[model samples]
Target: MIRDGERVTLGDTAVTAHATPGHTMGSMSWSWRACQAMTCKAIVFAASLNPVSSDGYRYTAAASRPIVAGFRHSYRVMQSLPCDLLITAHADQDGATDRFRTAPGACRALAASSRTKLAARLRADGPAR
Candidate 1:
């Protein structure tokens, strides 16, 4: 298994792994630097941060405590990533397809968006146990 924070080498690129266990217990994110001629860009492939659950699953359930905590941690991890390009597991989740320019704050914005989604779900479904 690829452990969190481990760097895997691929050709001349080094992809660093990040554990972003929101969508699942073993969800992962990756970051790497890519260059073209002269300039290089920091790119991050963030994992799906959605607060999805199976039918009848409850975020407030005792067994879901770790999953809920994972969501929160995933948000923090996404926000802290330093990258010129941000790619999410779900293209629509972070607006990666419609972006025409690089936004330094994209990672932060993506994290905020995911956090908002979780908040909405928690409010609409169940606040707490």
Candidate 2:
């Protein structure tokens, strides 16, 4: 598994992992600099922010508290980055394909929005019961 904030090299590309544990523990997001000839851009592969389930699922369990906190932290980290491209597991989550062509700050905006939504959900649910 890739450790959070660890940078790994793939051929000429350097990718940094960011642990984002809300949807699942050990979930990761990645950031890298993509270069093409003289043009270069910072890109981020955002992790899934939506919750999912397989069989039995519980978000209010005591075991999930820390995982939820990790997601919040990861959202903050993502908001702080100035990436030119943002790709998430779902295109609609950040409108990666739709907005990538029109906006440079879409990733940051999406991060902030996701964080806000996550905060509200946590507040309303009050953690695992």
Clashes of each: 0, 1
TM-score each candidate. 0.89, 0.76
Name the lDDT value of residue 19 in candidate 2.
81
Please give, for residues 2-116, the per-residue lDDT of candidate 1 as tens digits. Answer: 9999999999999999999978889998999999999999898888888877787777778888988998988888878887998777756744665322688877888898888
Give the Å shift of residue 119 in candidate 1: 0.9
- Give the number of the best model, judged by TM-score: 1
Q: Give Cα-based local distance difference scores for all models.
A: 0.82, 0.72
Candidate 2 residue-wise lDDT at 37: 95
Kindly report which residue stretches of model 1 are placed more than 4 angstroms away from their true locations once superposed.
94-101
| Candidate 2, poorest ten consecutive residues by summed lDDT | 94-103
User: Compared with the true structure, what per-residue lDDT tens digits does model 2 show for residues 1-129?
Assistant: 678889999998999998877777778888899889999988888787765445454555687678668777777877777688877777566435542422677566766777777666656555567
**lDDT assessment of candidate 1:** 0.82
After superposition on all CA atoms, what RMSD does each candidate show versus the true structure?
Answer: 2.0, 3.1
Q: Model 1: which residue pairs collide?
A: none
